[model samples]
Target: MSTPALQHIAAVGAGRMGRGIAIAFAYAGHEVALIDIKPRALEATAKLETESLAEIGSSLRMLADLGMFDAGELPAIMARVRFVGLADAPAALEGADVVFEGVPEVLDGKRDAFAFICEHVRADAIVASTTSTFLVTDLAAFVTHPERLLNAHWLNPAYIVPLVELSPHPGTSAEVVDAMKAMLERAGKVPVVCAAAPGFIVPRLQALIMNEAARMIEQGIATAEEIDKATRYGFGFRFASIGVVEFIDFGGNDILYYASRYLAQAIDPTRFAPPAIVEQYMEEGRIGLKTGKGFYDYTGVDPDAYRRDVLGRSLGMLRHLDLLRAPGAALRPKE
Candidate 1:
């Protein structure tokens, strides 16, 4: 006879990412219980999660307009979600096959929460942390069953963004890694395994760029708008499919080597040299994007419009490049 399917799941924390993660599992047909410390937080998270799902439904309806489902389907999806407080987290998690800890980005707090979870969760049940900053090995230190702990880092707005970085500590079993990956994929996420390095893969690369961008703004090398334009239109388009290493290989090692040397000499060896202008802008609180006043004024700008426009254009160009054999492939370093 076939074994029973892993059914019940629980998500700890009712923050932005926690709620999104809970909804993702619910959408995938799992029974999910969400736990938050405060009643008001739980109430707000429940409402927001429901609304976000409706927005997703609206987008799908506007685009593909799939008749197989209706807007009412959102409420049905909501029915699968249940909210609980700290006292009930254990009982709520009873029989859970997977448990995700979406706690605050604090090391100590997460340790305490995961320890509490360990007291009740099944020994074999998979436990994961949605920490973007902490290393999986470090967090796993607090887990009773370290072998079952893994870092399942999801980008913001968890349901939509396809990338889910699954990082496992040295003690973590291969089965746990595979299980987490399989389950995330089933829930409509594209899971990528990452080494337990600082900030992992994506964030590490992205951070450097952002830091340099901020520094550029401070130094007056470029305005925030210009910096974004160069990355989005100029460098972003080229880097989307083929990463930097391959780009360098394709662009010819001589240029990359010369550029590296130039940067090494011209720029301070200490971290990304916070350009003088960037320091001033940051001191004055002109941190870009979210702030209405950064290096430029986005006071009247529609943030969503920019996001949709950029992602839409990038995705379109990506598809086109794939069809054309991606000219950047020539630059990839030989394996």
Candidate 2:
């Protein structure tokens, strides 16, 4: 939004991720070329273009109605996103500032897409793969300037998600990382740099939480509705205000150390055991808030003010859920 970070953007696939990326750039006032470079029938290509544009248009209109922008500007933003067939791939990619490849998840599909995209895109262009499966290293192996390639793992509905996990290989240039981050930031995205590890950041934590939720249901700990409410009001609300590590330190690491041990013994020890780092921290006496040290340090901090801030945030969440009420509403005796 600030000075139009990238004027020329391109997405090399006509699928959901590609469409979402196109809509995002188009919304930010950049011209985007959504190119489907795979060989296909004329009818199939036309159908793909139709589907992509329709979805993008609907999304733009919804945002406009939600007061994100003037409804009159919807057509102009949608106009910025154009679809190109394989024959026009060269012109669509020429002089492009950034290219996002959102092909299928298989290695062969990714390799083929990269081999084709690399030949047309500028050597310095910030090329990125939207693959949730392979690491940046795996995909960068197909490019000539591997330093220019990175994994920009966007959450589903890229146009709405604020976080973009940027995973770079060991040899990726530092300059590229900074430039890529700047571009994403200018487009109103929060880019987090990560290693070429599997699942980047969100996916890894989400996977563990999701499977555990399913296990709880199977074990009859709570019903589906109750778990959903708890997550929405408790787990999600808290994490939304503070980072996971911050919560650990806010409540004292000793709490987690003991809770983890109890769960490990009561349930599956393999699943609930705390990491070795937790034990090491205990040994060193870094037992959070009260100790003035933990996963985070509280040294020199006004304890009362810090607690007040955290409470205010929680109260805000409660207000949003419409659960806050007057003290007089607490109870009433039945007749």
Candidate 3:
């Protein structure tokens, strides 16, 4: 028999990430309450939630048709969700096993949101944050139950992506950590325990590479599209499977040394040197992947074309990597 949905899941701030996360829990058969500050925001969230769920349901049907799932399960999964607002958040979470806070990235906002939640939630409910940067310990300061507040950072579009870094505050109890792990595992996520730090691990690593890529483009060393293409086609595919160190080992240290030394010198390596916001997007003229132009053109191109192109390349790389790593497949245990 399939696992039952998480009885009660509370999600605050039904914006992009919030809506996606709420839908993820709902899709997994949990009843979700999505809270927002404004009524209009709540309305928008509900509409987006419907659209997201429909798209997700269609995808699941495709998988089932391909023999990935038995017949007639997706609808039942969709049926298990509901949404609410801040005033109702506490009531909805009365006996909630887990509460996922996807509030604004700002510190004061999250503190207030959690403070309100702490007043309403049951003592046993494990309050988890989907924060990208704010320190968990700091966020926990607003709540009486710091031990229950942990950072469960899910990659964008949480459903499809499997990596979730579960970083707990210093006060978080072992039981709370384990409960959070079990909750995510039941939802089919690959949860990694990480120490609480700025950007945690994946974000920190990705930002480093992405920052360098941005600097290269800004300095006219390469176009934004060229940098992205090179990264994805050249090392991106390989790194997904083998990881950096393993890829270095496979390529032999000599070639690695040469590339690192040459590339490092060619590009700025001040490390977080270029300001983040300035480098986040390409120059106004260089807005690729949007406005029907970037390094490529999409004036008359079907929007879905981009998705198909990306999916094709990514899936192929993943398939190849899986085959290569099958013999040694296992989770990396935390130190």
Candidate 4:
């Protein structure tokens, strides 16, 4: 089946997320309808419209100040987004090529919004929920056409953030996913697909890291300031250059396996214990790049060249941070 062009974009529930999404698409030169799904009095609706547009305008101005684009282009970008009231939602939705539901994280609210959206939207139009709390599978049940529904989890400050996690249920159409990915890519966003799992990817990984950081502070291991500085300069900086899984392969999975065992014995066994896959991999001798295979295949790959490439990436990050210094540069003595 041919995927339709997602030219007409609409974001239901004109809250912060909707407004952010509107800015994103409008900045990308798409006309986006920021629709308010809830019924409101004329004055209340007007107030919402004012507040939403003002917030969006402020965000755009901030981005402009940060040199994202020229300040003069703000008006044109702002003009591309139209605020629609509940009365006009049907018309707005009917014309949308893709609809994003940004309603509150209440199950009943989502059910009502999806029911309203599915009624007016075209059968072919893609309906994506900009939800961080609910699963795609759970939301799909509310949609009239399950294949056209999926979850697009955008990070906060949607216009600035590059990543958008796409979670599709079993019944979701592959075409829908591809089309949405293409549209997001065109909008200068990085879209990654994940199964219908809790916390998706970033949140799931970060939860553990964040909790550990808190635990360290609670245990008097490190102050909050120190941990944050370490995270910014070391943990985040390194991970920014290489993915966690890729790092495991680069450093050798055996390192992780052994470290896991040590941590388990030293600290909390249940929390630090290695998964079965790591143990199995160690048993099978499928450790990492050193062994020609691990999380990624390195067959027919030149180890020396790959190592150089990794070093180059790390060097690039250092250069970006202005942390790279000349070989003979002298360090200043503490006064």
Candidate 5:
């Protein structure tokens, strides 16, 4: 089925994630309904509505103060989001083209939320769980139309983060995934699809990095401040220009193979041992740019041009960080 125009958006649960999602869509000029699905006393519900809007307004004002947009537009953006209590959830959800389930991560909570959401929303309305813990396949059991359900894992501070990882189950429809991608693209989000897996993409990669960083601290290798500085200026700087796999390809797989072997012996073999693919690549001579084969094929690519492009990307990052300087300029004494 063709994707419907996602003009109306709803975020159920009215929590931190839901508020973030609401602001993200509202910031992109879409009208959003921030619905609190739990039944509560009238006063409690009213208080929650007040708190949700207050936090959203505070975030918008902070963004405006940072020159992200004119302060004048805050009113318009804030107005685009409405707080709906449990009694109004059905009406709010029925009109949504996309419904993001942002309820707590507990299995029972998610099951009930999905059941209530599916009961209210149109069958074709995209039902995406902003779940960081559960797999899309697991949540699909709670949803009525499994094909229309998927996991959209948005990073914290979701309004600013461009990435939204879309994890679809085996039964999820291709059309549904395509439609969700289109909807996110329209909202200026970078949506990448991945199979239903633990931790999705960014989380999976980041968890390893975080654990290593913690291990370094535990081993007294570096202070927290020193590690963060190194991450910002060294590790993150290069990565901002190229992807991890691309960096391996550019540097040569042999480098990784040797380094991994050394680290495995020097530190922990379980954590540092090279995977089978790296060993296979080393044996087959698919080293990298030098060999014209690696994680990415470089067979048709011009070697010199590709190197120049990589250099350009690094230079662009240096310029962005204001670290690029003219040759011999630093050596010259200031006037």
Candidate 6:
């Protein structure tokens, strides 16, 4: 039997991240109480709620128009997300199964948010800080129950993005991580656990790639349009079919080893040199797919079937991008 949806979900900080997270949970068939950390007069709170709910309603309508659900379901979906002002946060959070604290990026702001959260949230509540700025360790000192705290780094437009990067510190409970994973999965999210490192996963990798893209432009390696085109047709297309490390294995680690050496020598060794693991793998005869080993073991896998599946995925991407053509079509001159 499938797990039942979470009983109570609360998102603190009714701003963009809070609103997005609230919509995501509400769309998953749960009512989410969205509370703003900022205090205001009753009239101001009412105004904020009115504007915030309007935005939420419009966002839901936009999603519906995109065929996320029925267009007519907007009212019902919007009704699931209720806004709570600072005055009502304690009562609103009393029984919350999971509380997402997305107050702000500043350290003082997080400390204040946690102090408020711990004072009212139930002892068993799985409290998470939806912070991309601070690691779980950074905020743990402010929490009453440090084990309940971890970082649930949601990408922007949280309702649409499927991935949520979960970073847990050493003091975090194993069960809390599992519970968060299960809860997120039940809400149709993909959760990947990573160490409490700066940039987590996607951000760190993208930072390097994005900086390189900018550097290429600065160096006049390619025009902006050409760079984007190449990325779409070549770099992005290839990675869409296989992961970075997986691609290394599929293409043979030996290729990267030599290419790295050549680039290091020709351009800049500091920038292009391969990590020690690559050279060590080559020395150990664990080169790649042909050698039956590399970053991942392929001992029991059927090579031909894997090859076909990868080809099919790559072809699918090309087909989607409208770049697929008859074999050797590029080789023939245009009429």
Tell me the lDDT of candidate 4. 0.94
Question: Which candidate model has the greater TM-score, 3 or 4?
Answer: 4
Candidate 6 stretches greater than 4 Å from native: 1-5, 324-335
Worst 10-residue lDDT window for candidate 2 reads 1-10
TM-score (C-alpha) between model 4 and the true structure = 0.97
> How would you encode candidate 5's per-residue C-alpha lDDT over 1-335 as one tens digit per residue?
55577789999989999999999999999999999999899999999999999999999999999999999999999999999999989999999999999999899999999999999999878899999999998899899988888899999899999899999999888999998898899888999999988989899999999999999999999999999999998999989888899999999999999999999999999999999999999999999989999989998999899889989999999999999989999899998
Q: Order of candidates by lDDT, top first?
A: 4, 5, 6, 2, 1, 3
Q: Write the per-residue lDDT of candidate 2 for residues 1-335, one digit (tens) a residue.
A: 11223569999889899999998888888899999999999999999889889999998889889998999998899889899999989988876888999998889988888898888987778889988999998877898788888899999899999999999898788887888888888889999999999989999999999999999999999999999999998899999877899899898888999999999999989999999999999999999888999988787999889999989988888898898987877685544
Off by over 4 Å in 3: 1-7, 37-74, 248-335
Clashing pairs in 3: 288-294
Cα lDDT of model 1 by residue, 1-335, tens digit: 11125578888887678777866777788888877643456667568546644654454444235553466667667677777776677788666888888888888888788878898888878888889978988887788878988898888778668889999999888888887778778888999998888887788888888998999999989999988878876788877745565443333334444455567578864553445555565567555555555545667878778657656765777677564345677798866
lDDT, model 3? 0.69
Of the two candidates 5 and 6, the one with more favorable lDDT, higher being better, is: 5
User: Model 4 clash pairs?
Assistant: none
Best by lDDT: 4
Candidate 4 stretches with Cα past 4 Å from truth are 331-335
**Of 1 and 6, the candidate ranking higher by TM-score:** 6
Instruction: Tell me each candidate's TM-score.
Output: 0.70, 0.93, 0.68, 0.97, 0.97, 0.92
Q: After superposition, how far is residue 8 of candidate 5 from its true place, in Å?
A: 0.9
Relative to the true structure, how large is the alpha-carbon lDDT of every model? Answer: 0.73, 0.88, 0.69, 0.94, 0.93, 0.89
Q: Which has the better TM-score: candidate 2, or candidate 3?
A: 2
Tens-place lDDT digits, model 4, residues 155-265: 988998899999999998999999999999999999999999999999999899999999999999999999999999899999988889999999999999999999999
Separately for all candidates shown, the number of backbone clashes (residues 3 or more apart, or on different chains) is: 6, 0, 1, 0, 0, 0
